[model samples]
Target: MGLPLLMLASGSAALAAPAAAANDETCRPTIESPWVRAAPPGAKSLAAYLVLRNGCGTAVEVVDVESLDFGTPMIHRTVEEGGVSRMRPAGKLVLAPGESLRFEPGGLHLMLMQPLRPLAEGDVARVRLVLADGRRLFAQFPVRRSAP
Candidate 1:
């Protein structure tokens, strides 16, 4: 049997945290400091950020992400071309062994679109990342009033 899928949502003061270990030893990615920006009223989308750390001896690829709070969750990156800033799809993120990747403002992030409901500060959103090795990692991202 496989590990159960985790559902993380916020209503209380304490946020949900992801598991520190994986069911299989070959793949273990630790997620830390997950958070979503508090969207303005009627806003259509928001960005989520976190740190992904590979603790295994091999590389791991994060192929996709899913969330129940939004209609779609896509990996995205902010780019500047000809002095114009734009957002683009980031196909996949590969992490080398013992590597840590940070998703922050003005960099790689998760584009959460078509929110099922409005989000505010202190709200928690549930997100799951799909890996190339067929492993799913769950995380809880808190909605913050400002970027951390």
Candidate 2:
């Protein structure tokens, strides 16, 4: 009924040109196959997982993630300690050269809260990822009933 709480970060606004360029020596992040898992009816929380491919020789740290659909879109990791599983904020996520990080269930994922609306099958959401180097990568996530 109202505007979505999730919105993309503005980190890339200043570096749009360079970020769009391919294979830039400074910093570059290749995002591929991003999608949101299906949620049950009346579900208040959801997770978005994707693969971040680092092209630059140096490592890139994901400083923050912004989404207008959630009250707080943060980077969180599932920690299993003492045989107990809990979710905590991941201050920063790092990616090395040619490295691809997977954000999947039961692991690191984007903790989306207070969805603007229930995610239905075949729905697509736009998300923006901000890298520590001030690069913003835009991505669209398809809402799938299940993930392989």
Number of the top lDDT candidate: 1
Write one digit per residue (lDDT tens) for candidate 2, span 1-148.
1333222334445468655554464556887888888789888888888888987777788988877666777789999989999998876688878889988889988887788877787988777888765678888888886674
TM-scores for candidates 1 onward, in order: 0.81, 0.76
TM-score winner among the candidates?
Answer: 1
Q: Which stretches of candidate 1 lie over 4 Å from their true place?
A: 1-27
Q: Across residues 30-112, which tens digit of lDDT does each residue of candidate 1 receive? A: 99999999989888899999999998977899999999899988999999989998999986689999999998999899999
Query: What TM-score would candidate 2 get against the native?
Result: 0.76
Query: lDDT of each model, Cα atoms only?
Result: 0.86, 0.78
For each candidate, C-alpha RMSD in Å? 13.4, 13.6
